[model samples]
Target chain A: MSQFVMPSLGADMEDGTLVEQLVAPGDPVQRGDVIAAVETQKGAIEIEAFEDGFLDRWLVPLGAKVPVGTPLAMIRTGDPPATPDIPQPKDPAVPPPPPETPQPAEPDLPPAVPEDPPLAPEPPAPPPEKMGTSHRQRVTPAARRRAAQTGFDLSALGGDRVISLDDVPSAPTADAPKPLSAMRQAIAAAMARSKREIPHYYLSDTIDLTAAEAFIASRNADLPPDARLLIAVLFIRATARAAQSFPEFNGYFEEEHFSPSAAAHVGMAINLRGGGLVAPALLDANEGNLETLMMRLRDLVMRVRKGRFKARELAEPTITVTSLGDRGVAGITGVIFPPQVAIVGIGTPGWQPMVIDGQLVARRVANITLAADHRVSDGHRGARFLRSIIDHLQQPEAL
Target chain B: MNDKDIRALMIRQLGQIAPDVPFDTVDPDADLRDEFDIDSMDFLTLITALGKELGLSMPETDYDQMRSFVGLQRYLSSHVT
Candidate 1:
């Protein structure tokens, strides 16, 4: 028998809602068959089978949400169906026999006359014996008193039904109500863990965006509506390049080991207006040109904003970049979105005075704050990474 | 503000914080933080925008009570009145 469980579609997808079941029990299924549709943080995705067999049972029903690796269905290869035998009821007309025939009033016992003993016993119909009911089972003294005072029927309320003194429910108190959505709960857990476990170190620098801004404007003038450049795209591309320069930043932390990756998958923290955040990855971002990066970023932002992103998009990001320029934030330190070693926070663009060779000149500036896990990368390496990103942003034509 | 007015304000505030969020698909009673991924910064931005628009001082703790649209509407209605 083969088990069809919800596969780990991505590293970050821990659980999913069984949105729909495409096949039913007793159905013969083949390899690559779409058995069910599951919804993750990203969106609805179909789950497929890996081998051919007869689907024996549907362990999880439609609308039943389950964790990743939970068995959703089972399949058996060329197995015969087993039939269960049914039991017939006995005739109700026949009456059951008398349990034991009154156990034949024990033989060899003699009957005695009651006249001799009755006289002495009668002398003391001992003043009506006081009913001293010592509780045999364990119960609270308070409960006993309450039962005595209120005449609460002890027989009806006692035994296993009565909670122990230590197990009694306490008085009700108000608790902060929490949201029930699994996705939101998971996000809270991840963020809380990230904030708590990751030892963060921040490095901030002002990038001269004069040339980049002009380049973006000129490019936007000739581009279509969907292909226009946003400051975030440039930030994403630069961050990706920076990650390549400092591979230590693009990696996941495991038990006593820092596994640095070769690929530069950038997770962009896209803000949703109502009240949450989603960081979707722009995969192979370092290898993409400005146009491709811009297009992919545009598509991702749009899809994320509309809540149409797939589960795959939220996983395996080597690094992350969150821009607050649109919301008018000049600069803010972002917490390292964990497992990933670094996050780049982009501030609103403005003009700042800087020295060029021997003369002071005003230039367009944007503060970029890089928050890295200190355990994985140090301050010197972080500075170098930031400088590389600044270099890329300054030289837009080369990016 | 009335309930309708509060909803409109929330939708507008949402747009400002997350220009890409789909307002029409959201449940008014759904937690803004949970459903839309609004972070603390976004929450602050929304409160600031709403404070400026309503000309009222709203406290940070007030956000805790304003989870859903109905909840926010009720809060605004009670406090504004």
Candidate 2:
């Protein structure tokens, strides 16, 4: 039996609580099938099974917080030599709607206490509190989980030793519309780390999209509505193609070394309905056509909102693109997510007067900006990379 | 489809794109993008959904014309058979 340990969702995640188990003992599972939902600081992440086999059993009980790399379940591969069979859970009949009695902290204290405090015992060990009192700031696991979900710093509650349910504040007293959710906290931490470590240089240029728009219009005229392409798809395709041309911006920078990736996985930044944002990769972006890319983007957006994402999507984005086109922003400069060398930002397209063939004509134009790690590339290289995107966009038939 | 039926269908199609939009508060002539939080994606979804429901094909050239409630109704009435 092969052990399925908790897969780290992102660099920011330390530990996560197994919220729900989707598979039962003896159930067959494929490699990519989602087997469990883990609640981390990032939110409810659906954990996919990495190995194909019969799910032997859950190793960790639900609601128990465990650090990263902890074994979550056992997948019976039955491939190698005689393996020891793990006994099935005692009550295997009941599945995971209600977590089978959270393993209570097995205390060292003596059991079998009288209904009333035994006579002659000096104030009889004060009715052993259900919540642990040994720790100076004792907060119940359930309470801590709730606080994390609500983004309230429990440490804010001054030196109170034993914390009860009532001690946790429900909301933050600030002007913000809503208190930062766990996802927002995670995003902030990641961005802060990105900005602190990566020395970034930004370049912006307004690209005329008149020819590209016309090309898209003609191309989309014959297709069905669902199959029709969006300008954003063109944006991604062009960027992917440009990255293929200018290889400097399309890879990870690690250990004071720049590794250029052969395959371009463009991370598309999707804003969540509830506050934060996640930029999951559009795998093999350079190879796909506009139609396939659009469909994949649609599916990715849908799955992301539903909290269903594969592990690779989160971890494998070599470069990211953040489009503020929907919101009427003019231009944006992104802070490169650490390890990833560059980030591309696209602004809203608007009609602007341009001189075409010595005549002023209204053309659809958008500001495309590139933020690259200065350690890997200079402004000249960044400008050339941006020019490549413009060149591809200008010739949309190639995209 | 009749004008009233088409309008009703259009509202339903729009609801699929953005369910939280208060239909009663929606101004037919105002740009939905500005009034509500309907982005380009939602706008495209709305157009696609309408096309699917009505068995019509909406070209990318006509997106701006069909962006608002009034614009969509006018465009559908004129372009659709």
Separately for all candidates shown, the number of backbone clashes (residues 3 or more apart, or on different chains) is: 8, 0
Rate residue A1 of model 2 by lDDT. 81
What would the per-residue lDDT of candidate 2 be over residues A1-399, giving only the tens digit for each residue?
A: 889998866655567778889998777888989998887654577788887888877887788677779888889874432443545547654344444543222222222234432223122232355486544556777666545544556667744576667777744222213334556566766788788888999899999988888887887889987887778888888878888887889988878799998888888888766457888889888776778889998888778766767666776788888888656778888888767889999998888999989999999999889999998899998999999998999988888
Worst 10 residues of 1 chain A by lDDT: A102-111
What's the residue-level lDDT of B12 in candidate 1?
Answer: 77
Q: Name every residue pair that clashes in candidate 2.
A: none
* Interface RMSD, one decimal, each candidate: 14.7, 2.0
| Docking band of candidate 1 | incorrect
Evaluated at residue A270, the lDDT of candidate 2 is 81
- Residue-level error in angstroms, candidate 1, position A196: 3.0
Residue A290 accuracy (lDDT) in model 1: 86
lDDT digits (tens) for residues B14-39 of candidate 1: 87666666877778788876555565
DockQ of 2: 0.52
Best by TM-score: 2
Model 2 chain A scores worst on lDDT over the 10 consecutive residues at: A103-112
Candidate 1 lDDT, tens digit per residue, A310-368? 44457567788888754356897887776888898888788788999989999888888
The collision pairs in model 1 are A275-B32, A275-B33, A275-B37, A275-B38, A276-B36, A276-B37, A276-B38, A277-B37
